[model samples]
Target: MLRTVAVPLLDPTASFELGVLCEVFGIDRTEQGVPAFDYRVCGEHPGRPVRTTSGYAVVADHGFDVLADADLIALPASTNHADHPPQLLEALRAAFDRGAWVMSVCSGAFVLGAAGLLDGRRCTTHWRLTDELAAAYPQAVVEPDVLYVEDGRVLTSAGTAAGIDAALHLVRRELGSGVAATIARRMVVPPQRDGGQRQYVETPVPRCDADTLQPVLAWAVERLHEDLGVERLAREAVLSQRTFARRFRAETGTTPHSWVTGQRVLLARRLLEDTDLSVDEVARRSGLGTAAMLRHHFAAVVGTTPVGYRRTFRQTA
Candidate 1:
């Protein structure tokens, strides 16, 4: 029963992002078997035309009063990244004080940070503005590489499309994966993107011409129960360890060991959600060897214990 209220700040980009949220949360999807949200679009002033960066004006039907009763408040990306109006900041602070889940899309993190909601919280913004955000708000734990960061109630997305991912994540968290999947299928977008994935680049995808490592990755994924090492994969790729390490990082934006660990963690999550395996069995099957080791890596990467994750996501069969 999440009630969503979007604060459409003055600017084209922010308005468009607000429109995106509306398309996702405001639409009545009961025909598709998806639960509908109590959604509202609020502006600083009621019945006023707000200017957008997209060279148009949008008239809002409500004002900040809608936010006071909202269970969730979304701050869409703003054109002016450096400044937030005093009244808007005060309104957001009041909303947060009332225990509402607050979220931001792309540069919208700037607005949240300005309102002091993101202080000491792990958050992310568009990768292009990561440096500026970090320099401006040193207290925020800024994760530049993540597509989005869900730090309890305060969620922030990396960029435009990543906002959709973040919104779907909220849907999954609140309404369940089945509902989220239905929404995604209707929108023709992936049900989920690993939050840790790098943002999509406009540059052409690099062709893996010299890559003898395709088989190695496939083999590693299939045999995740076994201990894996760079040297072992290097042999499979027909390259020395050093050469393999360099190539792996270049292609994946991560070290080989890190990539293997991530894959194992992902496998463990799937098992936890889809099976009733004991922690020890899941750890063994995912190549972490022991329950204690699973807890350590799971806590580090997934930010939760295996048992805890299962309790949250396990589907009853």
Candidate 2:
């Protein structure tokens, strides 16, 4: 359903966030069996150079007119968010009113707020600026901790890599996990990261030899169908239970149990899309143990029953 995407350029663009949108939607992946979106990079004036924060300028081939036909309109971060052209704000409102998906990355949420789109809607921006966003738009319910939030057709993401997480989530929701996974594989990013995950980890990832859990975590993912309790993982990592627990939280920003549960849920999602396995079989293979348990956790994490999720995605797959 998301066939066309339009991104309007503003002055002093954050190139990394803009690049995220281009990488996710602009690339031609039809050879890989993923749908190719009609991706448009637009400026208020066609062929005008737009300044980027990285000390470079890029030109847009299209103008704001292209947005009228867009299935989605994504906003990248800019140095200036409080003030946008009246026409740009009106165009955003018109696109939203016509039921097109609208998304913002980091400080770009302020543009959406300025457009009156965030009013009475739950949204989020980067954690560093969450209070600013909330204060500027008092009616908007701003969730500071999460990577992203989806309310109706609008999506907002936190800083940097979180944009990839949020964009892949939208792809998975609209095109099925298989398509999202293909795109992620080509991009060399994890296929899924729960939007509810903390935006700020004590350490974004393990950076030292002693602190790195890469090997143990990789080992755990392959053996997710087995019991991945802290005791067992600690034994594999050669650390005592208490030390392992402390380090796991420091490295991954979540408990071992929570991380394992998330992996299992991801496995269950893949099975639902790629196989004809019954709910009970999927539960067993995903290490969920039982159908009732799968339904409970699947709904809690995925916002839908296993059966419903399969029915919706399998059609596209």
Candidate 3:
């Protein structure tokens, strides 16, 4: 059981993002058989009416002192990008020094960076502010394209909706994929997405033009059992291999080969959790061809063998 303390700085965006953390982590969901987290919203000063950027105020009952015993500390997105409160930074440093997992959503990374927690660590924030973050903290490696970045004890997310992804990932890491998926299903979200994905996916400006690669992607998804090479996909799209490769990368921010591999791994994970399929059958069905091939790429991309991932995440029907 993890005790989470959310330190919401005074601002509209940060307060709302803190509310999201409360909804995801603080609420009791044991009826769904999901483990409940002990969560509380605290402020730098207790019982004070903290103003939000959106012309709202929230009163928090606890102060920075609540952070000492927390298993996790969350800093939500803030409106003020220039500086964070000094006392809050001190409390965050103390919590991290005590070995608590510290996380931030969007510009909340600023708070973590202020505490010197992000130094020498790979982290991310909103793309619009990536340059500022990089300029402000020369010691941190800022990855602008990623949705989130987890560096040991500290985790930082890109922006708004990506905050949910970061929070769910933390649940997946602490609990298991099964529990995380349950929560995500209840929340009507895809259970897992690679943290290195783009924060804002560029959609075609017009809906009609949005059919860019839908047909090809759908065709590829349907044929997960077959080896999907770039030539085959290009043929399906009626384009040359070079054009298809460039278009695919532009559309997905990943190569066709890498995208296919990632999709296969995802399919394999879904099978591991939801079915009683043998590893060999799963490998064949997910397009990796054989169990040995599946094990190799699964370990390379997922950091676990097929059997091990199944053992860790499988849920009995």
RMSD of each: 9.4, 10.7, 9.0
Q: Please write out the lDDT profile of model 3 over residues 1-317, one tens digit for every residue.
A: 45565655545456567766876788788999888676777876778788876678888888777777888888888877765667778878888898888999889898788889989999999888888998988999998878788999898988777888888898889888888898888888778654243313321211113477768887898798996999899999999999989888787777888888878887888898899999999999999999999988887666557787677579898
Model 2, 1-317: lDDT tens per residue? 99999999988789999999999999999999999899999988879899999999999999888888789999999989677878778889999999999999888899999999999999998878888999999999998767888999999998877889889999999999999999999999988754343313222322224547888988888887899899999999999999999998888888999888888888888888899999999999999999999988887666667887776566344
| Candidate 3, superposed: residue stretches over 4 Å from native | 12-15, 194-317
Report the lDDT tens digits of candidate 1 across residue range 1-317: 56565655654456657766876788889999987687777777778887777777788788777777787888788778865667778777887787777889889999889989889999999877888999989999998778788987898998877888898888899888999999899888888864343313222322334456666777788888876898788887889999989988877778888888888888888889899989999999999999999989987777667887777579888
TM-score of each: 0.63, 0.64, 0.62
Worst 10 residues of 3 by lDDT: 199-208
Clashes of each: 4, 0, 2
Between which residue pairs do clashes occur in model 2? none
Q: After superposition, how far is residue 116 of candidate 3 from its true place, in Å?
A: 0.4
The candidate 2 region of ten consecutive residues with least summed lDDT is 199-208
Q: What are the runs in model 2 whose C-alpha is more than 4 Å off?
A: 194-317
